[model samples]
Target chain A: MELTRHYLIRRFREYYHKAKIYEPIEFRMREWAFVPLKNFPDFVMVRHVSFSEMEELREFLISNVPAHVYFSSAYYLKPSAEMDEKGWTGADLIFDIDYDHLPTKSLESAKREVFKLLRILEKDFGIDEKEIEVCFSGNRGYHVHVYDERFRELGNMERREIVDYLTLRGFKLKGTQFDRVCKIIHRYVRDGKVNVDEKTGEILRSSLNEIRKGRLDLIPPEVREELIERCLKKLVVHVDPPVTADVKRLIRLPNSLHGKTGFRVVLIDLNDLESFNPYVDAVAFGDESVKVRLLKKVRVNFGGERYILERGRHSLPEYLAVFLMCRGVALYGH
Target chain B: MRRPFLPILPYLERYPFLKIGSKLFKFSKDEVLSNVEKARDFVEKVLEDKVEFDFKPIDFLCSNCGIREECEGYEGCSYNISSAEYHLKLSRAKKAVLNWLRCKVVVSNLDEFLRRRFAVKLARLYRDLILKECDDFILFMADDFGLNHEGFSIHVADYLKYAVRMKSDDWKLVNRFLSKGYVDLSRNEFVRLMEKVIKEILMEKVQINLNVRLKVDFKRKELERLPLKVECFPECMKSILSDLNEGKNVPHTGRFAIASFLINIGYDVENVVDVFRNAPDFDEDKTRYQVEHIAGLRGKGERYVAPSCETMKSWGLCVWSCEVDHPIKFYRRCLSGGDKGKRSSKRKGDSQDYA
Candidate 1:
């Protein structure tokens, strides 16, 4: 089902011709990179590219029609120079919540994780709701960026702590700080909020008095661990570590089309995120009929349509056809 | 302040103190000359003391950790700090003398090295005194940062300046008492960061002269001379070398690490190039140029060292858990022909000024 490089490039060009790709915030201060749609599933990014004017980025997008467009999260004095030569001014603190990295690997899980992350950022980190910019990655995750000047100059170690805070990595529930974790476990065990086997549940039920008193050892170690794990699961926010830690990371640009699924990398307000549907809302192509040879059986479920297709030549709406073709599950011009 | 004398100082930040001694510390010629002798005596006394520091949690519910609910630390401050303040200031005055010495002059890496050790030693004493006096001083410092201590937490934004500087995993926010809108700290946590801040500030001011000679003879033993021994190579390095010698397409990190290690271990560019002869895509000109570049001949002209053991582990180059912090440490162990050999080289003499 691998599409030819020429096919993807040609298809990508058509989308860019009318894509209306917009620049990221602080466009002139950031470095840009592009990995052209070629050699399916493999790409070498061309970076250290910048633009002084609006027309340059626009013209370049039209000419290049990059498969995956990215811009540095950091602001640099010389955006097009070598890494060491480019003076580092500041960077946006980024958090990535990819569904693939989650235990369930479901979009529903990713949404829940993003909510947990937002809560921690808003609550623990005290980052304002308005200051947090959440964007659909146009693929499998959400990219949350904080452009607050206070958080910008945080070095790698500081960001490492922030990530560790979100994930609760190496957090121990035994000493001076264990009181909070004990409280969390107590509520879960006492209220039967934890999911465990009947015997473990019975143990938790039997140890209600001890649990209420924050004495976890009154129950079996297995049940104790299970309760603690499940309780903390609600508290831990799953984020891709490197995306947040790496100051120089080049993130997929908003408003640019994700070359893989031919969807727009769009931003969503915090209020609207609950109902945000990437497949439906992120679709950039219109419903003009187009010919495509389906090489693999696949399902198209969003954008107010559902089609379980077979392997054959079929005339589909341009929106559906482009998605299938760009995903490399089909070929153009049946 | 009194301490045992250091034989020879360790390698420390030398440039700031030596290169800009007078301008940095803002001392006049007479003031610098006279105080240098006084500062040397003060440093000798300060270095003579054995500083013992330990933080054991007392399990007592402490307040003023910027958190209101609860905190971990020793007993809370229960007494008036009128004398405590005087005691703290006395230490500060003594430390200021050493601070001036640290900033004013450093022979090679001499004073620079001693300053770092002095700061930490003094800081440990400072932290204990602060704890004994009560968290009032700690709270006072936090207030300077606009950090408000409430029920077992401080707002993350308010405390990041101090917390961000904490390197240990135990000091990570995850290990702290976390609540909605706050990160909790114990008494020890506050004092630890406060101590580090004291140490950093301690190194910022000092007095000494640009033209002075020490009547001390000491080998530069801090910069260890390691022999070119392949057998002494750590497993991580050995694997990379063998891979290149076997015409394998080693990862970029592996190649850089091996090349840096070879260059650091006294391999000539031509000799290193010969090792890469069997590389998958070996090109003589490119290999030689890269080797030369790593040897600090071209571009930045900064010689590269092999990545540390932690970095090696991160890069997945480590084949086994080598009991050393760096590949070079492993090599040193091999050369010593033991598991871990210790060395002590000390040279002590009074530094005299010559007109």
Candidate 2:
């Protein structure tokens, strides 16, 4: 049987009341939007809030639980006003790395990709360890927030440039000094401006030319092909560019329960990011068994475990039951 | 005995020529043959530091002197020297240092070149001795030498100076440090320093997670002016740009569609690449190469065409219908005239051609 919207909202409120909510930096200045179950998804009410006002907001949520909760990445003097009139201040640099956005079939690789982007920010950009924050989306993604004071006022073009650098967009091999060395040694260009043999005269041009022509047999023992390969590999990182570029974006509020998954969007430490499994770690409901009627044959991976469902009645953990019911695919009291 | 006025050895060595009243001459024993023995004995005693000699009335060249710019004299001129000579020396020093760092010089003669060349030795003088011995010379060099002029030459000396300037504001201390001399470092150590400095500079250039927006409004006004909006875009390409702009990772195929469509529509490679800046793992060189490849600027000279509307529909990328068989046709029609000829026979002809 399908749970009534009222029952779903009530359970969500209970989960919210029991869970420990994360406090985002400068939480008081953020704009919040709530979509109620009674209205269309597009219909949302926005409000400006401070940390001190969170208790009242929580009380409102508990009374009439929203279907979805979203917070602006931007800060404003007066939020919930007309777009042109709101006294917008600044925003945090947020990155949303979603598994569904990538073509990878397994969630494992997608999570690895997220780590890869984060590592670039840490190692290449030299961002301080504490300045970067990672969190689970409570569904199929990771969100990274950068709260460095230096980045607050960057415009979209500058943000886009950062994204370009990270993603290797418009990066030219011809412009790189290392690649120029490789090209000169291998005679890829006819310009005599680059004379590499003067240093290591042992590198004969005939052999280099043969190697350049794809005749690997003519490769000299002194030539380290790996050097060129390594330089080439250093050129690019695959990432979603728009996240860094969009200044006025909305992000799912941390510590809020996801409407569909019945999972909590929790902040995760960078050290613990690799081992974080959203299905297991973010489950908001208790382990009480509940009877749910499956609407169709489906497979799900949740809470670090997999479940296969057939088109029939089945007993599931309370969180999974709520997840399916909220997804509108199963009836909990059939 | 006719006493010859013998000059101070340190001052003489720094300025080998002596001004006899108005005319400057090399300090030769022939000029004062009557007291040659006395001069020789005075020079020997002065060299041995056994006797202190008084400084001669030296004539320093002024900047206005004709010989100042071109003079290669070993010591101070009879007239005041021009800053142009100092600038020339500094420029050469920067070039020599950069050349050595870039491995442009013959490895065997590097030490000899460094010691003999004015360019190389002058750099050493500033970096090791002059800055400590005299503040005026360092000030002179600093005023004459420019960081902007050193093109394509990466030297640790300049990099260190830049780093120091970036860190501290005390010019006196910085000048003192420069004069006190850099530690004797191996060639490889210098190279490593240059590499580290370059990497730091690159990191600064590639700033990450700056919460800034584009000052140049990203809205393509021309695109907006077209009769067709994003609704005309194949769902795949539209979603790809949206996802990229929103910082959501997109499938490779989605990226390919956007790139191909943008390239086909005559968007510059940089603009096309800008669209992908929000991609999760972006690399400028790689994206440029990829976009260039799709644009037929790289690879085997074959420009990639955007996938057909029917193919996009098959891939579930077509969420709306415009009755056009191809994406290019839709875009073309949109650019030409939007909705005015919605029921035109031109679309019918395109449908029949595909059918």
Give the residue spans of candidate 1 off by over 4 A.
Answer: A1-26, A36-44, A52-56, A59-64, A174-184, A191-214, A229-236, A293-312, A329-331, B1-115, B128-136, B142-169, B180-182, B202-355
In Å, residue A129's CA in model 2 sits off its true spot by 1.7
User: What docking grade does candidate 1 earn?
Assistant: acceptable
lDDT (Cα, 0-100) at A114 in candidate 2: 72
Scored against the true structure, residue B48 in model 2 reaches a CA lDDT of 34
What does the lDDT read for residue A56 in candidate 1? Answer: 88
Query: Candidate 1 on B1-355: residue-level lDDT in tens?
Result: 1111110011011111222222223434554355465544434444455434343422122333344333222223222235555355434433454445533354213455566555666666767755763344346455443455563256664456567655455666776655654666777776676676666655554343354344433233443245676777776777888888778899878888988887776777887888888888989998887888788777445576677766676677876555466777777777777534222211112212111
Least lDDT summed over 10 consecutive residues: which range in candidate 1 chain B? B4-13
Expressed as tens digits, the lDDT of each residue in A295-333 for candidate 1 is 878887764577899998899987778778777788877
In order, the interface RMSDs are: 4.2, 15.8
- Over B1-355, each residue of candidate 2 has an lDDT whose tens digit, in order, gives 1111121122223322112211222223223332333433332332233543233433322323475465544334333434665445334443333332222112122232221232222233223332232332222222223321122222223433333323122211111111111222233333333333332321222111122221222223333234425555544466678889999987676788888888777677898999989888999988998999888775335577776665566455664556666767777775567553244434322554445
lDDT against the true structure, per candidate, is 0.67, 0.54
Model 2, position A260, has a per-residue lDDT of 66
